[model samples]
Target: MSSFLKVLFRNVLNGPSTDPFPLGETFTPDRLRGKVLIDPELCMGCGTCKEVCTAGAIDLSELADGSGFRITVWQNSCCLCASCRHYCPTGAASLIPDWHAAHPEEDKYVRIEQQTVKYEPCSNCGTLMRPIPAKLARKLYASSPELDPEQLRHLCPACRRLRDALKGRPFPVAAAKVPAEAQA
Candidate 1:
């Protein structure tokens, strides 16, 4: 009893071993994993994030109207491994340091992070296509001043390929298929 009293007195004088988290600032370290986020504008609907997710927490689906794609991240299923963020081609997947993921068991299924990325019609061919974001387009075509990135942004894949292959050449039989507006 005397020894116990001595230990108790020492501990009391030393102060609380654990922080009062609810009433005070919690210890959040740098590089802490918290909420998974997807930037709709930056994301190109590539399945790289879903493919790299270690926990199988990410899902990609086409919208019902076929206008866009949807990405879903199950917060509860994510193991906070951050593989998605690391492997994302566009740097669209990220984690914010707002670790408020805890919730009652009943809410587990509803805890999800979702975003939609829409498609635009190709200006040349009138086909639906994902537009190359201006930033990425500029990076890809920066060295080629002859190729206008903004103009090519409106072309479908086939038209863009044709334009690139026939940049300095005359209009061949195949090139005749491109309309006057698309040719210019």
Candidate 2:
């Protein structure tokens, strides 16, 4: 009984231990998985996110014109599993700490994230394709000074392999204008 009274007095003096959220500022941690987001610049259109999503919240599709691809995430269906963020090779999928997902019935279907990534024509063959993201390209070929990393990002897979085969020889046809230093 004495120890119980001591704890009660300590609790009374310390006040409430719970955060006053909804009425005041609260603590949001860095690792909290709240909302799903996709970065268009970094997405590879690989459909890995859609595959890993257990709740079937992610949808990936080719555009009608076939120029590019579209990705969508139905916020209502997402289970906050963070599977997409884990399996994504490009690190485009992210779970931001914005836990305000409440919505009315009418707006439930409308609460979606949609993004379209267009394909740029390959510098070599003019074939429409998605170029490797510049950030990824730099990291991949960062060690090679002889290789023009900027030009390499613009080429299609076939042209990229062809460039590799050339082995520092003069390119058969200009994929894109080489910089002055690269030409030298």
Q: What are the per-model C-alpha RMSD values against the true structure?
A: 5.0, 5.8
Instruction: Report, for every candidate in turn, its global Cα lDDT versus the true structure.
Output: 0.83, 0.87
Worst lDDT run of 10 residues, candidate 2, spans: 175-184
Ten residues in a row with the worst lDDT in model 1? 174-183
Give candidate 2 misplaced runs (Cα > 4 Å).
173-184
* lDDT, candidate 1, at 173: 64
Model 2's alpha-carbon lDDT is 0.87
Q: Which candidate leads in TM-score?
A: 2
Q: Write the per-residue lDDT of candidate 1 for residues 23-132, one digit (tens) a residue.
A: 88788877788889998878888899889888999999999999999999999889989899899877888898888767888997899999988899877566677888
- Clash count of each predicted structure: 0, 0
Model 2, TM vs. native = 0.87
Model 1 RMSD in Å is 5.0
